[model samples]
Target: MIPLARRAAIGAVLVGSIAAGVLPAGAAQARPLTPATDREVTFTVDGTVTYGTLHLPVHRRGQRMPAVLLLPGSGSTDRNGDQPPALTPHTLAKLADALARDGVASLRFDKYGSGRTGLGAYADKPETIDYPAFVRQADAAYRLLARQPEVDRRAVRLIGHSEGALTALMVAVAAEPRTAGVGLLQPLAERFLDVLARQLHEQLAAAVAAGQMSPEEQRAIGRAVDRAVADLRAHRPIDTSAMPAALAALFQGLGGPSRRYVESIDAVDPASVARRLPPRTPALLTCGTIDPQVPCDTTTPLATALARAHTAGPGRVVLPGVGHDLTDPADPDVLAPAALDALHRFMRCGAPAAR
Candidate 1:
């Protein structure tokens, strides 16, 4: 219920708002969204290939519209950004629907090394599992978005959540001479090790508080994290690739090592990226305090960094009671109203002229 709104002419963005996620509420009826012609397509990057679904208005293509490239977080979650258990599902799809209602268009696809490739695509995958790889895919998506003829090549934006946000920033950074703007939600700010350490600690503490994690198990995790952080500091990948003795199998068997996944997570430094962007490109970053995933504290640092360095043009925050999915305090079937509101504002408002 905590709403944060700020307006600035730092660029052309009219209104920017954000709020932290809070406790969940009861579920509600699911409203069926109007059917749009969904097209399944594929693209290539560095000799590798991936697929995606394009959701466009049923109308003919003429005027280009602002678009968002939606990316899911870690793990095998598909393009819709669906995860397991009680945590919100269908978040990305809902967001896309909302944007479409406001005259905006969006394109989202499954992460590479999966889907088309199949059978542990990760192992056969190239270094695109790393930062450079993601940047290239996003650039390819941009070309696809811009070439749609119905898309306003200059008005496109990125709406990345969780690990996707990092990928988005990299996309935007490398796309400096191309993208229009970027909208970040629940992006991880701490170094990979720091956030992992914190998450593991919190989980362990919660288990201890609930009498689940044995004292020995908790101690082992702590030892593992300490070692991992040290290795990362020494310039190692800090993921399964480098943490061979500990989480190697967990990461390798799952797919690529976690290190390759977050390879350049630190490269997501919003402060510096903001400054490098053309004065015309705007940036919006947000996260929730109550989020079970990304911490709310991370958002402010990015905002402050952008503002202090004068990098986040038209940047702001939104605090709604939910998690990384931006679910509402009152409904599971629907994302909080604020998430819808932010999408509307981002799409309706004009983007900073392409840098």
Candidate 2:
């Protein structure tokens, strides 16, 4: 389950300080978040109608404002960073509202399997969906934002979290002249399978450390993962009958679109893409030091590559004690201040008041 959830930020069991029975020090009940004006918007990609919410800041007419396209992480996560059975902290919605307050407009959409899209063109057949489709959706959204009367065509930026980070990069690198920059939060920086295998190894090793899994069991799990990867690489069906329940879920996902998507992206190295980005294309690479899905060590090197390309803004930010969800590592309910500050700074890059 952990492996599958980490694959696309889907189905991963939710954990936090409350779940761990260790609340944050002095943590208090959170106040109700203020609602902002969110307009229902739709766009067509490959003839498939996609749905989303456009967040707008208060502004007078004729004011051409900067805008951002928000891409949520993997799985069936809606525009709010939630996949039912797992309630997120409304991470993407919060970010949208935050951007609005900072005088920037934002658009956040529900991908195929989530929200109003309802699988779109992949309703009956899941195998047709892959990484390129995500990139196309993001590209269409960016174009829509740029054409809005209230938006500055040259100031359209993209913000992607988790797997969406790769989609954002794809859009940025393939964007029209209007693309301003990109912000990657908790990006997957390695080959898709390598990252998944490493995560599985870590989980198994941790279980062994806690006396829950024996050395033999751990080795067996490693061998199983290797075989599954080999099969996926060959475009063959994965055999999960012999796997543990948690791991079986991961491979069972390989029977559908997840399999095709994973296979398509497993070979696309994110750092290699970053290194080739146009020098003037600014980027913000952020990672939480404690993000279980994406290790800070992995993001650090991607940041270094972007910096070498002269596309990084300031430097990589590893927020202390934050989670893959961009909230308190211990208490998922609490938003991390450092992450918010860094995002704010990155969104406002190159302005007179840029941090």
TM-score leader: 2
- How well does candidate 1 match the true structure in TM-score terms? 0.74
Off by over 4 Å in 1: 1-35, 58-61, 83-88, 117-128, 211-223, 233-258, 266-275, 309-314, 351-355
lDDT of 1 by residue, 1-355 (tens): 1112343343224221111123233211132333456778778766656778777754433445677788766555567876444443876788788777766678887776444423223465444366566667767876777677667666778878777776676677656336667777777655555676678678777877899867877777667667666655565544443343535454344233545455465445655554455544567676765786677775666676556644434576666665677878777778788777665565545564322
Positional deviation of residue 267's Cα in model 2 after best superposition, in angstroms:
2.6
Clashing pairs in 2: 1-246, 17-330
What TM value does model 2 have? 0.85
Runs of candidate 2 exceeding 4 Å displacement:
1-36, 239-242, 329-334, 352-355
1-355: candidate 2 lDDT, tens digit per residue: 0122364443223343344367655332232333446789999897689999988887654566788999988778899888876676688988887788788889999887898887888887778888888888888888888778777766789889898888888788767754678889888877788888899889889999999989999999888888888889998888775579979887877756677788888868888887777776768888887788998887766887898778847557888888888886556665688888988878767643210
RMSD of 1: 11.6
All candidates' TM-scores? 0.74, 0.85
